[model samples]
Target: MTLEHKRPRLEIEYCTQCRWLPRATWMAQELLTTFEKELGEVARVPGTGGVFEVRLDGEGVWSRKSDAAFTDAAELKRLVRDRIAPDRTLGHSER
Candidate 1:
C-alpha cells in the first residue's frame, strides 16, 4: 500500500555480452532519482545480442536496436516524464 506499489514500474533490459550493465544501471539511477515518487520500481534486466531497451509498465519507450543509439540522460528523463508524469517539469533536463 505504499506509493512505490501504486506508481509505475520501469525496466531496463541490457545485453550482458555487450557489457551494458553500467549503462543500464546509470539510466536506472537517473530515472529513480528523477521520478522517485512517480515510479514504483526500476529494474535492470539482463539480456544478450546488444539489446538495450527501456520499458515503462512493460511498454517500450526506447530501444537501441530501433533508435540506433543509446538514449542520453535528458532524453530518457523526458520520455519517462511524458509517460508517467506528463505535467511534471524536469528542471535542467527540460533543456
Candidate 2:
C-alpha cells in the first residue's frame, strides 16, 4: 500500500495590537473554505507591530509589511492554490 502524505498547514500571523483579528480571521475562513480538502489546517497566530504574514508548511507566502498592502482574497487564494493545488481552478475566485 502507498502512504498518503498529509496536506500542508497554513499559518496566518496578524497583529493583535493593531486589531487585525477580523481581517486575519476572514482570510483564514476564506482559505479554509476554498481549500478544505487540500489544507491540513489554517492557524491564526497572534502577533504585534503590525504583522500580517501567511505561511504554508513553514514557508513564507505573503507579508503585508514587505508587500506594503493587504492581499485580497482572490489573490491570496491564487497564491495558495499555486502552491497546494496548481491545477485546481478556483471558479469565481479566479476572476
Candidate 3:
C-alpha cells in the first residue's frame, strides 16, 4: 500500500510583463524549475499566492527584485496580535 500527501509552498513564476521585458523571464522559469526539483523542501503550491517583481536585462539574469509577505486571515491576526492586544503590549509606539 501507498499514501500521498501535499505540502504548501511558494510558487514563483514569470507572470505577465510590459512589452519590453527581457527574455530572461523564460530562462528564469526554467532555472527555477531545475533548482526547485533538486531542492525538495521548496514546495511548489500553485496559487498559494504571493507578490514578486522582476526586471530583466540579460538572457540569464534578472534584477529589481521585490517580494512581500503572504498570510491568511488567521496568520494575519496572529502577526498583529501583540500590537493590538493590551496584555501583550509590544506595540509599535513602545519606547
Candidate 4:
C-alpha cells in the first residue's frame, strides 16, 4: 500500500449552529496543503453547542471548550505534525 493509506486522518469538528464551517474548512485546507503527503484525509464534522475540535486518527488534539481558545493556523499545524509527521519540519510554523 502507498503512504497515503498509512497516513493519519485529520478531522475537524465544528458547530454548525455556531456557523463555524468556514473556520473548520479553513483549518482543513491549511492542514491538507501543508501535509499533502503525510495525511490520509482531512474531514469536516458538523456538530452543535459551539464545538470546535481537531482530531487525528480519532484522537483529540485540540478542543475549543477545554483549550479555551481556537487553535491558530501555526499551532494547528504543529499539533498535527507532531502526531502524523513528528520528524517533519514545518519551516516558519515552527517559529
TM for every model, in the order presented, reads 0.94, 0.94, 0.21, 0.92
Highest-TM-score candidate:
2
lDDT of 2 at 70: 92
Candidate 1 residue pairs in clash (backbone atoms < 3 Å): none
Q: Report every candidate's CA lDDT.
A: 0.92, 0.95, 0.29, 0.91
Top-lDDT candidate index: 2
lDDT, candidate 3, 1-95, per-residue tens: 12233322222333233222222344334434433432223222122122232211112111224324322323322333332232543333243
For every candidate in turn, the CA RMSD to the true structure comes to 1.9, 1.8, 14.5, 1.8
Residue 7 alpha-carbon offset, candidate 1, angstroms: 0.9
**Model 4 residue 40 CA deviation in Å:** 0.6
Error (Å) of candidate 3 at residue 73 is 35
Worst 10 residues of 2 by lDDT: 1-10
Off by over 4 Å in 2: 1-4
Model 2: per-residue Cα lDDT over 1-95, one tens digit each:
13377888999999999999999999999999999999989999999999999999999999998898898999999999999999999999888
Worst 10 residues of 3 by lDDT: 55-64
- Pitting candidate 1 against candidate 4, the one with the higher lDDT is 1
Predicted structure 1: lDDT = 0.92
Q: Model 1, poorest ten-residue lDDT window?
A: 1-10
